[model samples]
Target: MPIRAGEWLAHGSQPEWTMTVVEKTQGAPRDAGPLAELDDHGLVAACLAGRRDAFDLLVDRHKRSVYLLCYRFVGTHEDASDLSQDVFLRAYRGLRRFRGDSSFATWLYRIGVNVCLNRVSMRQPLQRSLDEMPNLAAPQADPAVALVRREEARRVRAAVARLPRKQRTALILRVYHDLPHKEIASALGTSVGAVKANFFHALANLKKLLAADTRSGS
Candidate 1:
């Protein structure tokens, strides 16, 4: 999923909440100037100083990753898009609270994880899997092989989703995002030891879940 700048949240089907928040904080458009060269922290400073375009650049840099994280949790484009937008909206409102203790991306990930967990808690478990099987299968691949692989992938995803919250989050960050334990600890607001423990337990539990599924022929 290639996320174009200003396109995902601008879709007509997006929730009304994002529109209100954007209208309130969005500054007038201007030329990129030198702001494009800035790092995340520099961009944050620029945004706080009223350079709204700086925030736009930050969005362009991180939105795809954020959307993917949300998609992994929710298993659908619509819900992921909504949750992604909500995460950014919260980040924008809480910009002042971003104390440079972690990298901007890590801070954003924390916000994204919290938003995803809250959304997941309020809804029933997702039965649909991510729309990524097409990418996994080659154009000329056997249909039966592709079907089997897709089903396996779906079951794996469902199993991951069912893990306890900390375990699930730790696994996703470490495996999918490739974040180191130290960085994951920062995003999760825990120590590295705790993150490692959760990750180990997550892998153990996931293996058991998959083995059970295989036994049941599900």
Candidate 2:
């Protein structure tokens, strides 16, 4: 996908397939043709130009990852879906502030992190459990082994949630989302050094938390 500049939407949906375009004689959509080929910035431009379909494309592209991030925060599919929509809505409303300082995905993730953090703080002690880890077994694999792995993943997630805010954010963005320290720093509004320090402590603390859990037979 190529990122190009447009007068409007200089920055930033769903899957490419879900965007249905219709040809109109007047007010024909810009970048309507081959929208999937345009990069995120280009789509943002189109969206600014009043092409709703372009925003839909952006949502399709990012919805899965955004939902996953929200799920990790709230730990429920329903809440995650609602937060994902809220994230996109906020992004759409705040598009003018994007500034193109970071990649579109990074900017969107920053918004998501803020939204999730606010939600978590409002409802201290997030009630849901993180049991949505991917299935690691073949169809014929042993159920007991899968259950054990799921339990371990759940414990690890619980430990992560217990981490200090900065450490948890650093670890989640770095480990789960595969974000670089620089990007995580940008998202966290902190320095790369701080991000690294937090991530390191997050790992060490996570190990201690899990070990304690084991010793306690939990």
Candidate 3:
């Protein structure tokens, strides 16, 4: 669980069974995450000028959050890493086109949602397999309580994944990313009103499904 350098990844049948081993406890201070030495515009400029190291800084700051979002959307670690990589690659390609009208973080997440949507569309919305969720919560003293909590989180995530792609993107952007509705609208190339509409419907549908689940104990 240590965030050390040169970790080895070992995966079992389920992602929860996978683990990492760190070779070193610490690294250089320069590798520390981007603490806003450059604004979004400056970073983008450096990236466009072929300073690849600048892009690495951006990724270090946002990759953890972005990968977690992808894992929630796709329900698998194998695919989430791929999706996260794809998101960064797409952002790299599109950096030249980014008008700087929006913050670069917002631009990156906009692309992240689109990548997740494309991934979901390739599979049937209702065909989620629930045996592979990764447990990121703190471990509970009682194993039964931990199992129940993990199962409940997986069920909720599956329901969210099944939503229409736009609605899912809207809800995750606004909720997980803690993005404002107005910013989400700009990211998705829509209006604030449309973002609200998606969030409203997405929340309503998820609530209904989760309520039914509680009643049935599924």
lDDT of each: 0.85, 0.81, 0.79
Model 2 CA lDDT for position 18: 35
**RMSD to true structure for each model, in Å:** 10.3, 12.1, 8.7
| Candidate 1 TM-score to native | 0.80
* C-alpha root-mean-square deviation, candidate 2: 12.1
TM-score for predicted model 2 compared with the true structure? 0.79
Lowest lDDT 10-residue stretch of candidate 2: 7-16
Off by over 4 Å in 1: 1-30, 129-140
Candidate 3 global TM-score: 0.79
Better of 1 and 2 by lDDT: 1
| 1-218 per-residue lDDT for model 2 (tens digits) | 33323323334322233333444534324556877678889889888888788888888789888998887777666788899999999999988787788888899989999998898778754444435544454632777777777777677878887888778888888998999999989887889999999999999999999999999984
Candidate 3 lDDT over 6-79, as tens digits, reads: 23444523334434565563322254346348766887898798877777777877788789888768877888
TM-score of each: 0.80, 0.79, 0.79
Best by TM-score: 1
Clashing pairs in model 2? 9-45, 13-57, 13-58, 13-59, 13-60, 13-61, 14-59, 14-60, 14-61, 15-60
